[model samples]
Target chain A: MISDTAVESDTAVETQRGLVEIYSTTKSFHGNTVLKDVSVCVKPGSVTALIGPSGSGKSTLLRCINGLEPIDSGVLKVNGEHVGVVERSDGFYSLNRKKRALQRVSVGLVFQHFNLFDNFTALENVAIAPMQVLKRSKSEAYETARSYLDRVGMLERADHYPSQLSGGQQQRVAIARCLAMKPDVLLFDEPTSALDPELVGEVLDVIRKVSASGKTMVLSTHEIGFARQIADQVVFLDEGRVCEAGPVEQVLDNPREARTQKFLERVFG
Target chain B: MAQHPADLMESINKPRITRKTKTEKTAWIVLAVVAVLIVHTLISNPNFEWATVGRYFFGFPVLKGLLLTIILTIVSMALGTLIGLVLAVLKIMNITPITILVDLYLTFFRGTPILVQLIFWFNIAALFPDLFLGIPFTDIGWGINVNAIMTPLVAAVIGLSLNEGAYTAENIRGGFLSVGKGQLEAADSLGFSEWTKITRIIIPQSLPTIIPATGNRLIGMFKETTLVSVLGVADLLQSVQLIYSRNYETIPLLIVACLWYLIITLALSYPQKKIEDRYSKHKNSGGKVTATTEGVKLG
Candidate 1:
């Protein structure tokens, strides 16, 4: 039976602040450990950037947060709801579509490729979650989609399909799609890394605006300058572990970890 | 446009025949052969039985059987497609025993011949005198009986639908697999549930891949209906077989069924082609397909 309270519970959980927390999260794929014994927290109104090099497990960390990738062991809680796992060896017991979708709404995610549904126009793509999954009426979803598109300055391109738009336009539409769901925390897994060099600025600009609007965002990005500008805290990941995590200025300016020093030198030497 | 092969060899030293010249030469050759056959047949056989041909062409049994064949084909295909979709989804899921059970179904249906399966279903009363679906030792409440209700039409539907289900599952699975995993992940992150992911994003995008296979299956199913004549179901082929066994005119009776099948096939194929053309708008045209599709095979 479908319940009318799913959206209402989700909204209530999201409305309460300082509720998202992760404790001792660890993940592996094909018996190879990717994120090992990871623990992180996102405050209600803070921007945290996960910065690292190739194969540093930054993307894995982000995916674990959303339960898209299963974690081998962990107790990750988003808005007081457990995700990814209930027990270490036994695995997740209550991992149903309902709970997974509920977690997705609370923590909206964007991928490296702007994986917008190419079959739908931008407006339909934006309206999808609200109307279909969240059970909002069509008109209500469309109005919200319009507002989010306007927020990303993509209102003009709402009628175009993802294939018809440029790389930056598609990414912005993806952002608008996340926004339409009104997630408490937005997770980006190298969102701008897939864009062309010329198109990068347009997408980073939208993220910058979202950050300025006080949306709590956790991003894994190689854009050093954007991180310096927008991030409140930057966590440096190296070989499936958090090497250095602190104030953006402290980590960028004075790294206590030798590996962080080496990474910063490689990025900004 | 009017270039002849003998004259064309003199104009340009191109060894390959010009398009118009080749067409004209082929046309003349075909016309000459047809004319010779017509003259020879006319001269040899004066009484060719044109009246018999006319009577069989407008025969009542043939017409009625054609309609019955079409109805069976439509009903069976529609039923098969629906059951196949459910089985395909069940096969793809992570539930341990269900996936295994669905795989077993695919294997048995796909590996066995359709005619054998039909015959086996028809002869089911002998094998399982008492129908039940419970554990071997435990008399549980999880079974249904087989003796009383497995009617001939029911058995035919069961046979056709089960056989087609296996092939449809493969087609649907292929279509689902062709859509990138990123699309599902993206829909996942968008807060779309599993069902929503399928109905909204995956299915719509996969339409381009699934529709062609589905149309092909529909055509195959249409012909597979003739296999039901073995069950004595009075479908088109059986109806014609009934009449021709008496008259002893095998060719004319076969011709009547053949013409009806051809007409139905052509009618269905027009819409199938239109659908193929519609969904094929985004297909990668740089590569080649077999001659069965809108492509050519050199060998």
Candidate 2:
């Protein structure tokens, strides 16, 4: 159903479930520019893979989408509201810390390093944010967390602390943590990059299941084959710029840009 | 290829024990002689006055002083730690004016001797004859006489807590820094409010680093309460001095005080070890195993 609507025309989608649009967004750290005038429109319920070499701004773009990294220029809109920035009658102004925190509730991010809260059990890590930020009752929040953990096949390890679990188990729990929030857009910054070879399958399988659930996902990854299989649209970023972006088959199978072609050959060949 | 159990046991016989070297023997002899001499001196010394020490060890005045010392340590350390948490948060937030203010407070309290601080507080009446509690440079507030409010006991508590707060703040700041940047970022991405992030995420992970150092501070605070004796707070040391002065039995009274301190110090150490072990349990079980997973190849 989603792909049928997506194929008809991207613009005709529901405004309430509209595309996550990034327009001319740029970001920098200190004096070094990390993302330079990047733009992409990710359709709701579609999986968008951002592929690039090291320091190619792929991770930066993923961070910018979820308001973890503030853009220096242009706008990022999730559903319809501008992320990290509030538009007032006078002009645009960055949201204050509290307001920004509230705005972030609609987006969830999975990190490369699987940064689970060390002191908490897997269940507590998933349950805490909903109880604290969303004001859900303790029982209800924990129930929701357990359901998400079940979805990610991590229910058995719910009581284990992050350090006690395997890396892939931790990442599965991390994914479950994001899912527990019921976010509109799920952003993964190389989620599988930190897992073991045998363990990588477990986390990827979880992400694949999450994607099938119709939550919009934007991920930056070095997994060429995985991206080719799951992504509806693939964007190749190089040197803080989007060198190529289009349908997954066109971009991954028959890339038009030299940089994209070279990246693919180096990874897939 | 299987062998009899008896034959296997015989084949795996343990190596013979070796004799102690000359240096090891000499060290043992020295330690034995020192132990004997110390015990002999303590038992035989006429100046020790074993009866007086035994009587005064659980006597009314010394017992009262011990109770006071315990109270002072608990109250001051609790108040100081609370203030230290606030100062640590302020410093970590990096608000320039507040950070500078915290730094100045830390430097002033930490740089000066505890004895001097106690004395200064006891004489606060000289610095501010009238204490005001309202807007500065305005006559809109009421004033109170300082001498009535700044009693020696109050002054002692104020001095000890302020000094302890500075040290605790530095330790807490170190704890906060020891938490990885990725952990903070993870918390932020989870939509954790700043308060939730600090209370739930940062402080808990930082505990392993902070607890051991804070334990050291707690014991130090217990010992440092003796400084309040200079202000006539009638603490353990002060109580001993009072008795010694009255009866001219200084050595036995001093021994009583030393024995009490040694006993309390030993008592505090057990809890500290338990807390350290509780926080560090994960270190032995899980962290190293995942690190080796980095080299595992994935397609």
TM-score values for chain B across all models: 0.76, 0.89
Q: List TM-scores for all candidates, in order.
A: 0.81, 0.89
Candidate 2 clash total?
0
Winning model by DockQ:
2
Q: Tell me, by TM-score, which candidate is best.
A: 2
DockQ of each: 0.32, 0.35
Which residue pairs clash in candidate 2?
none
Model 2 interface DockQ: 0.35
The local distance difference test score of each candidate is 0.79, 0.86
Model 2: residues with Cα > 4 Å off, grouped in runs? A1-18, A87-92, B1-11, B16-23, B134-143, B286-299
* Model 1 docking tier (incorrect/acceptable/medium/high): acceptable
Interface RMSD of each: 9.4, 8.1
lDDT at residue B5 of model 2 (Cα atoms): 92
Q: What overall lDDT, based on C-alpha atoms, would model 2 receive against the true structure?
A: 0.86
